[model samples]
Structures are given as structure tokens and as C-alpha cells.
Target: MNKMHDFEASLQVLRGSETDITSEVNVIKTAVASANKRTAIRFQELNQKKFRMPLILGIGLLVLQQLSGINAILFYAGSIFKTAGLTNSNLAACGVGAIALLATGVTTWLLDRAGRRILLIVTSSSL
Candidate 1:
């Protein structure tokens, strides 16, 4: 109740004198109702046949992402580099770490612009 009052106070401050607490409360109620409707619709959609492919693809992608050996490689990178005849194994490991960070940043930037299908194809192919 105290948090709700604080939220109302902040909202009142933002709206200035244009609206009252009742209006703010009504607005919140409307938003909640809208979200509930959307949730119900999504739940219904999940039961339909059309959504099956997408649901399977999402699950498969998640499983593949986990099963990939990237974590193990990163964990044993130093020894791997040493075994591969690198004189400075630490420097090689650091290079791998830098590449991983840069790849993550690049992937984030590309995801929104290139879209998921294209990005996934590119990343999977590169592997």
C-alpha cells in the first residue's frame, strides 16, 4: 500500500494539475486490463497448430545453444593454446577472450538490424 501511494505520488508529479488521482488509477486499471487480454490471447495462440513450428524451433535453438562446446573451449582455452604450440598461451587466451567479447557486441548490434533468422544462419554457419 505504501509503494502504491509512492507510485501515485510520482505519477501525480509527472501529470501536474492536468489529472487527478482517480484518473491515474483508472489509467493503471485500463493498462492492466489490456495486458491481461494480451496474455490470454497469447495463451490461446500457443495451443493452436500454427504456433507449433515456431515453438519447436525455439526449443531446438535453446538446446543447441547449450550443447555447443563454446563454454568448455573458453574454460580450457589456456591449455588448448599451449598444446597448439603457442609460446605465450596467456596472450592467446586473452586474444580469444577479446574476440568473444567483440563477437557478443557485434551480435547484439546485428540482431535488431539484421533480424533473428539471418543472424542465426550466419552464426551457425560460421561455427
Candidate 2:
């Protein structure tokens, strides 16, 4: 057998299994080769027509998020609360900070489960 088959056979022996793993090894090899080839061709693939829409949308969303004044609002939240006539403006600012922290924690948990697109849509719509 070839090197890959030899490796697979050795692994099977180490695992103390008599069942054949040739098909599994071939599948894994095929997937690895495809991944390597894709990496080599990635830049050329990026210039294709099919990739334009997603690229434009991704960049546009990032630019819009930066331009939305969210950072300024967060940074100056205490001043904003004071200006808005809150008697305990510091407390209000702290509340805002706490909420932001909680939201970040929730987002971290939900990101893998709900995915990027869903999270982006929910956040954008809420804002």
C-alpha cells in the first residue's frame, strides 16, 4: 500500500482495531488536498463575480457600524445622562455600562449557537 494506507494501517493497529479504515483515510486525504488547493487558489477565487456581493456587504456593514456614533455614545454616556436631567447621572451611567457588559456576555454565548448573520440582523434592527 501507499504511504497514507500504511499510516492508516498503523493507526488502526495502535487503536487495537481489526476493522478496515481505508475508506475513511481516503476521505480524509481528499478533504485535506481540497483544502490545500483551495488555499492556493483563494486570492484568485476572491476576484470572481460570485464573491463580490458578500464582500461589498461585509465592508459596508463594517463602515456603517463605525460611523454610527455608538462608540461616542458609550464613551460619553455619563455626560449624556447628566445632560438629560437624570438626578443620579453617575448611577445611570453605571447602569448603562452594566447593560453593555451583560449584552457582550450574552452575545458571546449566542454567537456560536445563533451565528453571525442572525446576530448582525438582530443588533442592526434593534439599533
lDDT of 1: 0.83
Clashing pairs in 2: none
Error of 2 at 82 (Å): 0.8
Model 2 vs. true fold: TM:
0.49
Model 1: residue 108 alpha-carbon error in angstroms: 2.9
Could you estimate the TM-score for every candidate?
0.54, 0.49
Per-residue lDDT of model 1, residues 36-83, tens digit only: 674345665786898888998899888887789777898999999999
Stretches of candidate 2 off by over 4 Å are 1-58, 125-127
In model 1, pairs of residues that clash are: none
10 residues in a row with least lDDT, candidate 2: 35-44
lDDT tens digits by residue: candidate 2, 16-95: 69777777777878887887673354776878999988888889888887889888998888899999999998899899
